[model samples]
Target: MVYQETVAAIKQLVRDGVVPGVNYAFIDQKDVTRGLFGAEQLIPGYEPLKPNQLYDVASLTKVVGTTNVILQLITEKRLALTDKVSDFLPEWQDQRVTIRHLLTHTSGITGYIPHRDKLSAAQLHDALLTMHVGENFEVKMVYSDVNFIFLGWIAEAILGQPIQTLIQKRVLDPLRMTHSTFQPEDPTRCVPTEVSPTRGLIRGVVHDPKAFVLKNHCGSAGLFSTLDDLIRFEQAMLFNTGQPIATHWLTELTRDQTPLGKQWRSLAWALLPTQLPVAHNCIWHSGYTGTFLVLDQTTQQGMVFLSNRVHPHAPNEAFLARRNAIINTYLAEKTVSSKTE
Candidate 1:
């Protein structure tokens, strides 16, 4: 399998101290796959990685957990993009921020905490409480985590449940993502994230300090999952063309909303824009924890890759270069033909 070569190359790069650990998965309309390389997770013992092994998905939680809840709330008419943040959280109305502003990170929120400190699990998340709103030019489209911070709170206000509980009920339960969760549930089955002196083994525990502090169930980050579980969640968003969400809310979500790196985003899905012509469109997303997933709806094919790449050490910048090559390789292997044109 060429994917083996792709894994080999990715693994080779990491063993050379390129990345901390790499875990990846890919999907088509049918089968799913998870591959691993490096040991940013376990150390010294040479334990082989497994498909069910959980890793800190980092910002992937934005889509897989918190964002999906937002979609459900919107579908139920419990929320709206145009709805001001203060509608659900009265304090947010003070800033007069809207869901659109929050989703696109242009809400004038000065990200709530440091990348290492963004996790606010059980706290009220009193967004503007600590954020600084940054400089004027930087506000054009700030990708602030605080936006989701408020979204999480807003979801709780509307749903009347903890954000984690709501995620399981709406998204995780439906998809049967057995290997995924916002809070660290099972220690043994999970791949410990970092072996750092301060954090220890980190197995089944979230490695992101922000998530760790925020009760491990914040909206912006803090969820542990396998690449396999991740892909299935992505595929679930494709239940359309006569499906419940497709004709209604999913369509709204699948449509591009702008400011999301040239793609229109609804909840967790980002639809790519085309300059020319094509047949079917593509819905995709990537994770900052050395993970990426892109689904080419046109070909009914998709790819997923996950890594603790940011653990123990920073992720290798070249990992993305390799990711691009592997994606093109997979698409070519499938002989993907754009239906969008």
Candidate 2:
């Protein structure tokens, strides 16, 4: 089976100590291509991971959760991609950066602010109001988390609710994702992340320090979800559900809008160009903390891999390289099949 082959390729890498645990799911329109195959809790000797276990989604939050909220605001006409971000956060006015630049990571904002340790969400918002954007960088797609952190505030202002609440009412509840959320607070249905000297055996809590500062409600890195829930989110996007977002904004969200060396990134995802010459309509996004997903809209298909792969250790690029190779190979197969048919 192609699914089995793909699973094996990922498993082979995991077996070689490439990643600690990987909970993956695939969705192909009516087929609902969902399955999980991987080890779990790679801390020396723990019981194997269950299919329902959760993992930190990391920057995948930027693509799935944060980007979705932005699109929701666009549909409501509360925001515009071309609208200047400073209109919402007037401190950003001096820079004259627009929402598109923020979404595409071209706002020339610095990568991070260590505000997590010292600010309440309201305090943090106030801090952001007073802080200044750096002047030394070029305006381009820099892929920073701070951009989305600010967008989260806009989501709150536009929707009149916190980001977590917006995600619940707008996203998770809409998709019936019962088990996914700002986890950790609900410890009964959560899994552990990393064991650290400061925070030993951290279970059901966010591993990201910035998010930790928001009390795990930060927009950039606070989501905890199962592989199955992620597949459902991908399904919604691939189907392009009309009730949630305008058709064009959804396309804008997934469209390849930036030139990233070889691949172009869309609003919150990466576009695997036709020149990858494999898939005609392929876009993907990967999480920093050992999670990855790809969406092939042309095929109405998606794949997700969720893992605490960096547990007790950091991630290696091998999984990413292999994943791309596998995805490209699948695209190649489809290409060949098309010719034969």
Candidate 3:
């Protein structure tokens, strides 16, 4: 019954039809508590949500896959945060953008390709490379998938392999995240995402438009992972054991890497917004597919929230409001618990 309030809040979300269901886990250095609430699929067929079912972790892929691999490469001295984007991809005209800028989302890279999902993989790559920075370059913090998209390609270029293979060898396998993958081998075992107009029921396949187009080449999104596997990732990060990433790099990821005025960003992770002292050391990231990860390095506590809010239809503002409430409640509870300890 630990985290009972947070658990009740999530159950209410399902009861209100905000999400079909949610599979979540709360982790600390000592133990992990997991919960499964509601159904995994309610539209095409009613399926009871079960443990170990893969959820399309959307942009969590950026942190769990691309960012992790990038850090490992840096640890191995194969890459540097200061390395210019143009150095790896000559088509990238901006010499000022560096690996650090992309990780912290200060790249200021801006552009939009119309019907970007309609483009072929090669076409998308070329268009993304054409995206240029504006006057805001490095002056503001803008969360953009384009940054991670470029990071994914850079990892591939440095390793001379596809991003899928690179992530498997560098991040997932090393961390023992066996169920995490860009490609899900069995569709039924995966939680269904949105029912896209073009793709119908998006089960197993990635729901991110850019990732769907780029397939295995994608870095921005397109990862399917189970709650158990993500708990493994969180434990690795918290304990700094059995992970390929160096201890220093892992520590750096939890600290603010951005300037004072800007929204605080850690390396590929967003710091929690609150006046609490612990908030400064807590990092988090969310996937578009109703998934998110939060880790408090100081307390050695973390959480994994996975749901299919986009399933059957897209989510509205109300869904988001409730989702934030659930997360906020959890954070508030954790804050109180930390004080007592």
Candidate 4:
């Protein structure tokens, strides 16, 4: 019944036209519950959404896929958070940027650029390497995709393999996250994103133009996954099975590294310090295509909310208020019960 209220809230939002379709799951350690609501396809035909449907997961890839690869590399002693960007890419040799700056989004790199149409793959790489950094690049956590994109390049350079392969070997395979991948082998099973004029009904392929132009294998974006796979991943972060990454490193990943903001981010995560008496800490990240994951490591509880919110139309902003409301409601209940006991 705890999850049912959240499910009903989602259904009400879908009915109110806030989002087209949503597939969400809540995991409290071993206990798990999920729900699917609304139409997965509302344009050409009406198709009911399914629990196993794949979502673009937009920028969520930065954390769930890309960040995990970087963490694994660090755990293996193959990379260091303090390693300079120029060390791996010679073009960046002049800039004093480090892996930590990239991970924390303080590299002074721009958030996004129209590189897909403006530059070739090689040219794009060069542009990213030569892009301007803030005068105080080491301090500001600007939250940019350029940081993760460059990190993806480093993963390939260090592993002598493509980023997708590195992710499969180091993350997906190790965690048994078989349902998640950079490119979904079965396109039909994927929930379609926005019907862009250039890309049409985006399905299976990445929704991010830069990642799509880069052949759907970038670190910043370009991942597809279901709620269940992400639930498993949350468990990995909480339990630290020690298969994909070390427990010490896992704890480090969530530790605040930047003092730039009131709610500073961790290595690749956005920390949400709650004033709620029930839960004191909540770290989360979201994607452009209407997906987000949140965890309360203190309680070993988390949830993944996946939706095709961009379908049929592109919004100026996401329903972040609704997202916060859901988390707040979910955690408040747990907190109240614990206090009552």
- Index of the highest-lDDT prediction: 3
Model 2 scores what on Cα lDDT?
0.68
Tens digits of lDDT, candidate 1, 164-262: 777777777777887677766678676655566766666677666655676633677777777777777667655442222434654455465644434
The clash numbers for all candidates, in the given order, read: 19, 2, 0, 0
Q: Write the per-residue lDDT of candidate 4 for residues 93-167, one digit (tens) a residue.
A: 555788888888877775245544667777777667767776657666687788898899988888888786777
Preferred candidate (TM-score higher): 1 or 3: 3
Tens-digit lDDT string for candidate 2 (1-341): 14666676667766877766567766655575555555666565565667777777788877767778888788787888778767776655455666776677766665344644566666666555554556523345677777788888778767677777777777778787767878646653555666777777666788776777764356888888887777777777789763345677655644666433333767777776542224465777777777777877766666777767657655555667776776776555544434543
TM-score, ranked from best to worst: 3, 4, 2, 1
lDDT scores of the candidates, listed in order:
0.63, 0.68, 0.86, 0.77
**TM-score of candidate 3 versus the correct structure, residues matched by position:** 0.95
Q: Ten consecutive residues with minimal summed lDDT in candidate 3?
A: 272-281
Model 3, range 1-341, lDDT digits (tens) per residue?
28889999999999998899999999866789999999999888899998889999999989888998899888888899899999999999879999989999999999878888789999999999998898667778989999999999999899888887788888888888888888888999999988878899989888988888899898888889999999998888888788667788777876778643356898899877644553456788998889999988778889999998898898644677887788899888887777777
Deviation from native of the Cα of residue 234 in model 2, angstroms: 1.3
Runs off by more than 4 Å, candidate 1: 1-12, 33-45, 111-124, 127-139, 239-254, 259-281, 315-341
TM-scores of all models?
0.80, 0.85, 0.95, 0.92
